[model samples]
Target: MKKENNTNKKAVCIMSGGMDSTLSAYMMKNQGYEVIAVHFNYDQRTQAKELACFENICESLHVKQKYILDLDFFKQLGASALTDTNIEVPTGGVEEGVPVTYVPFRNGIFLSMAAAIAEKEGAEVISIGVVEEDSSGYPDCREEYIQAMQKAINLGTKDDTKIEIKMPLVHLKKSQIVQEALHLDVPLELTWSCYKNEDKACGVCDSCRLRLNGFKKAGVNDPIPYA
Candidate 1:
């Protein structure tokens, strides 16, 4: 959707309705970019809840432009516990090595699609919230991978089209995320970080544990209820 007369610098933000992503989008908006939110529903276990949170978070952020892409192909190509029902979601404490919940090349796919959207929207930047220290061992969350993806994206696009991939929360710990979100007045309550059991968030899941621990470490109450 092209506006007849628009002069604002634009940013395509990949928001997952989680604290980190919400904070990242807020940071983009604070930097004077007209924020365009992009959310993906890849048939994850908590897809419905995540979608609901995404809507609410977008509304709270006053985001006028939003895209919800359904990558149903991810479900069909499922191998991870998040996309495949056969692989059980681990509930024990965070384990070493790559987590079973890691979606295969999910970020690569997302950034590729986002690059196309950025090219169309004339956006200069694409922002995603990927935490390293606080997350389970997910290979795709590393900054090096994102940096390489950014280089590839710029290289593959037209010479005139330059898009910067921004990961505002990449190096931050979960507690730092919580603190920053509070400072930015982000609607953290509307965010969902649970990997499974979306009705009230399975608090034992890796994602939930990280979120909860962040809030606890920040010495703040998590407004969202947990099961």
Candidate 2:
């Protein structure tokens, strides 16, 4: 009875305005999908900076359709260092267990939101930059978890809604991710990966450490500033 507005093959990409996420969005475009960039402001420490990066990245990607959703619940429920100022983001090195920076079920929540957009936009795919190997051991970044979410999303949406969650960097090491981003000509400088500090990246935070290490291993210079 209802006519659905359909266009070319489309994809909904959840970008954090970070290097990995930026690369994933680019990869989706390379795959010949009409990319709809979706970014969230969950009131993380670097929320403002990340939002800025997301805008710049979308411009570079030449994506006209974009969504920026502000979710203040993360600040209200802040056990993670990213959302709570009381908790310190780890800086020494990648810890053995899940770091304090792991926002509770962050990717799951993000994927759920992305799915809604995908189904509405008549998108066939959802892409996220969730790195598992050589990451800070975030449970939601695992391939199994993403696969499970994909199944759940398909089941929950309309019977004809077939959305596949694509984790381009899920299995790649940080170095490998860096290499792929470079190869894809993604605007890496427009991305930010710092977990602490806003102006200049702390360089020692878990996110910065991984990003720097990746560039080093890939023999590429990170264009972003560090303090």
Best by lDDT: 2
lDDT digits (tens) for residues 112-161 of candidate 1? 99999999999999999988777788888899999999999999999999
lDDT of 2 by residue, 1-227 (tens): 12234458898999889998899888888877888999999999999999999999999988989999999989999999999999988888878888889999989899999999999999999999988888889999899999999999998999999999988888899999988888888889899999997899999998999999999999989999999
lDDT of 1 at 154: 92
As for candidate 1, its clashing pairs are none
Measured with C-alpha atoms, the lDDT of residue 83 in candidate 2 is: 98
> What TM-score does structure 2 among the candidates reach?
0.96
The lDDT, on a scale of 0 to 1, for candidate 2 is 0.91
lDDT of each: 0.90, 0.91
How many residue pairs of model 1 clash at the backbone?
A: 0
TM-score of 1: 0.95
| CA RMSD (A), model 1 | 3.7
